[model samples]
Target: KLPPDDRLAVLLGVIFCIPGSRRAAMDDSEEDDRGPDESPKRPLKGQACRHTASKSSNDDEREDGANDGQERPSGSEGSPSKKKSRDNIPEPLSSLHGLVPESPPRFVSLEQIMTTANGVTNMMLAHEIAMDDTFKLTKQEHPEKSLEHTVKKILHQAFWQVLEDQLAENPPNYDQAMQLLQEAKETLLGLLLPHNTSLRAEIMEGLDVALVRQQAEHGTLDFGYYARLLISLMARMCAPVRDASVRDLLKIEGVVPLFRGIMDQLEVMKLDMVNFTIQEARPLIQSHSVAYAREKFRAYLETQALLSPGLDPLVHTRAWLRRSHEELRALSAQYSPDPVLNGRGASGPPFAVVLAKAYIQLLCWDPSWEYPETLSMDRERFTLLGAQVEECALVASVLLVTHSVGGASLQDISDFKEDLRSHTRLLLQGCGKCSEEELTEKLKCAASQAIKEVQESLQKHGFAPLQLSQERMLYDQVVSMASAEHHIRKLLTMRILDFIKLTLSSASVGPTKIPAGLSTLEKELTQIAGTFLRLVTHNRAVFGEVYTDIMAQLRAT
Candidate 1:
C-alpha cells in the first residue's frame, strides 16, 4: 500500500487531469524537463491525511464491506507506491480493472473553487447575440449596422429571456438568485470604483432593476442594499479620473434625466399594494452611503442660483409644505379610533412633518459656496412654515386640555391649574403665538374647557378671581376683542397691564392678606392687576407701558 500523502497527491493529479490523462502526463513531463540542478517537487508529508481518510472510511465500510464479504484492514500502514498508483488510476478504468483504492477523495483550494464559480456567474449574466437568415442581406448591405443589430437581437432573445425567467419564478431559488445578484453587484462595484462612466451607467440601469425585483419578491427592503448601490453610483459619478465628466453629470440640467427616472420608479412603487411606510423607507433613502448623493443634488441646485435669475427657494419650500398638508389631509380622512391606526395610513403626516423639517433645516444651515444668495430666502420661508406647525401643535394641545378638564370640580380645576399653567407657558414660549392678533384668534376658537383652564391658571397664579358672571362677561369681551380687526391691539394691552399690576401688588403684600381681612381685599385688587398685565404683554407694542404702569402701581401700594 502507498503512504497516505502520496495517495492524496496522485488523486489530485488524476482528478485535475484532462481526457486520456494527457494533462497529467504533460505535468509530469514538465517536471522532468527542469534541469538536474532544479529541486524536485516535494511530496506533502504527514499522518494527518491518512488518519482522517482511514477513520472516515472505516466508519462507512463496516456495514457495506460485510455485505460484500470484503475484509477490513486493522489500521496497518500501506506501501507508498501502491497507494500512489491506486489513487492515480482513473475511476472509470479502475472499476473496469476491478481495483479498489484506499485513499481519500481529492479536495481543491476554496479560493480556486470560488474564482471558477464567479466566472460561471459572469457568463450567465453576459449579453449575447443571435444569427438569422433574414439579416444576411441586410448585413451584406450594411456591415456596421448589421453587427450592431445582431448584437441587440442576441441580447434581447438570450440574455433578456434568462433574466425574465429568473424574475417570473415566485420566491426564486435563493442560492441561484443570490449568486446572480452578487455577481451583478460585484461587476457594477468594480466598474464604479475605476470611474468607468459609460460602463457604470449600463451597470447602474441593470442594478436598479435587480434591486426593485429583489425587494418585490422578498416582500421587504433592507437599508444596506440601497446603501451599497447609492455609494457605488455616487463614487463613480464623483471619481477624479472623470472630473470633467463628474461635473457634467452632476449639473442641474444633466441630472434631470436621472432624477426623473428614479422619481418615476418611486411613483410606480408607491402604487404597489404593499403597506410600506415612509418611516420604513427613510433610513434607506437617507443612509450615510447616499448622503453624498443628497449633498451633490443640493449643490447642483445651489449652482443654479447663479445661473437662473429670480429662482425662488419658496418653490421647493412650498412643494414640501404642500406635501405635508396633503399627508395631514389624508390622515384625517383615514382616521380610526384603534391602536392599529399607528400601522397603516395614520403615521404618514408625522413622517411628512419630519421630512419637511429636515429639508428646511438642510437649506437653512447650508454651507455650500453657492448658498449665500438663497440662504436668507430659505430662512424666511422656514420661519413662516414654523408658524403653521405651531398652529397645529396648539390645536392638538387644546384638544388634550379640553379632555383632561372635563367634568372636574372647582377644587380639581384649582389643583390642575399648576399643570395647566406649565403647559400653557411651554406652548406660549415654543409656538411664538404671543402676538395680539394670533392670541385673540386662538381664544375665539378655543374650547370652553380650555378657556376655563386659562382662567383657572390665571386665578391660581395670584391673579384676581372674578365672579362667575364677571368671568363669563370677560370671556365674551375677549372673544369679541379677538374677532375685531381693530380692537385686538388695545384689548391685549389693557388685559396684560391689569395682570402685571395684580401680581406685583399681591407679591408686595405677601402674608399680609392672611393676617388682616382688609389686606385680603388688597391682595384681590393686586391679583386683578397682575392678570391684566399678563394679557397686555402678549402684544409687544403695548408691553412697555403696561410693564411700567404695573411697577408704578406696585410701588405706590
Candidate 2:
C-alpha cells in the first residue's frame, strides 16, 4: 500500500475526476510529445474549459456503466450535481482490476484544476510547518517570495474551481465561499487606494485579491471565520443611519415625508433580501413544516376544554381561535428559516393564520347557537324573544370586527361609535310596531323590498361587490345575521297577533275590560325593537350605505 499522504492525494484526485480522466491522459501524452519550450495549457476562467473536458470523459464512463448493466438511480436526472457526484464514485470491481500487475496502471484523469487543489492545500500547510520548525532552527531566509509566486500563479484558477463547485449545487452553500469572493472585491478597492501607480494596479482593477489571499493562507478555508465576516459586512451595509445631524433633520415635521420615503425604500430592500435568502434555503427546508403545523394543531385540540355542554357555540369558537392562534404562532416561529407561503412578513402572523382563518370560515358557514325550537313567546315578553338569537348575530359581528382590524385605533373606535348611534336611531324608528299580525306581514314584505334596495344603493355609492376573501366573509355574516333577525321578527309578530285576538275576546265579555298584558306587551315590544336596533347599528359599517338606505325605508314605513 502507498503511504497515507500519497494515498489521500490519489484518493482526492480520483474522487474529483468527474469526466476529465480520459482527457487528462490524452493531454499528458500530447504534453510529452511537445518540446520543453511549451508549457502545460492552463484551465480557462470559470473553469469552463476543464469542466467541458470532464463532460466528454463522463459520457464514456456513463456508457461503460450502462454496458456493465448498472442501473441509474431515480431522481438523479433532475439533479445534475447529484448525478455527477454519483458517477464520480468508482466501482469496487473496477478498482480490483488495478491490482493486477499484468495489467497497466489505471489512467485517472482528474480535472487539471482539482489536481492542483492538494498542492495548494499542502503549500499552505508547509508554511505553517515551517513556522513551527523555526522554534528549533536558527535564523533562516523566509520562503515568502517563492510561496507568494506559487500562490499568485494558481490562486485565480483555484478560485474559479471553488466557485464552480459552490454554484453547481441545487441550494448553493453561499454562506462563506461566496462571501470570501465578495470580500475580495471590497479588499481590492482598498488595495487600489494604497497603490496609485504600482504594476499591480491594472490587474487589481479586475482581480479578486482577497479571495486569492484567502485561498493561499489556509490549508482549508475556515467557513466559520468567513461566515462571521459576512455577517459583520452585511450589518454594516444594512445598518440604520447613525448620523446625528441626519437624524435631527429627519425629526423635523417638514422633512418627515422625505424620511418616510427613505424608510419605505429601506423596508422594501430589506424584504427583498429576506425573500432572496428564503428562496435559497427552500431546498434545505423540508416538508416537515406542514407536518409541524398539523402536529401543533393537534396538540392544541388535545388541551382544549370542550367538556362543558353549556358553552355557546360562539364562545367555543372564540376559545378555539385564541388557542389556534397561539399554536400557529409557535409553528411560525419554528419555520422562521423557511419561506412563508402566505406572503406574510418573516415575523408576521403565524403560519397557522391561514389554517385558523379557514377554520373560522368553516365554522361560520354553519354557525349554531342555543335557541328555542319553537318560541313560546307571550305578548308581554314577545320582544325579549326577538332578541333570543342576538348572541349569534353578536358573535358574527365580533368576528367581522376582529378580522377587519388587528388593533382598533382611537379613530376606529370613534367611527364605530358614530355609526352605532346613527344605525340605532334608524332601526328603532323603522322596526318598532304595534303588536298585530297583518302589519307584521306588511313589514316583512317591505323589509324584503328594502333588502334589494339597500344592495342597489350600495352599488350606487361606488362600492364594488365583495371580491376579496375577507370582504366576502363579512358579507356572508351580514346575510346570516339578517336571516336570523327576520326569523325572530316573524315569531314576535305571531305573538302580537295572538295577544290581539285574546284582547278582542275579553273586550266582548266585559266592555270596559283591558287585556291583562296589554301594557306589558307594549313595553316588551319597544324593548325588543331597541335590542334589534342596537344589533343593526353595530353592524352597519360592514353593510355600508345599503344597510342605511334599507333601515331608513323601513323606518319611513
Give the candidate number with the greatest lDDT: 1
> Which one is best on TM-score?
1
Q: Which ten residues in a row have the lowest lDDT in candidate 1?
A: 127-136
TM-score for all models, in order of appearance: 0.22, 0.16
Number of backbone collisions per candidate: 29, 4
Clashing pairs in 2: 19-54, 20-54, 21-109, 430-555
Residue 5 CA displacement from its true place in model 1, Å: 62
| Candidate 2 local lDDT, 139-223, one digit each (tens) | 1233666884577447644654565565456554444344444433333232222345553344344344466455535545443
lDDT of 2 at 517: 26
lDDT of 1 by residue, 466-518 (tens): 45765465446434433324343333333332333334334354532221211
* Candidate 2 lDDT: 0.35
* Residue 195, candidate 1: alpha-carbon lDDT: 55
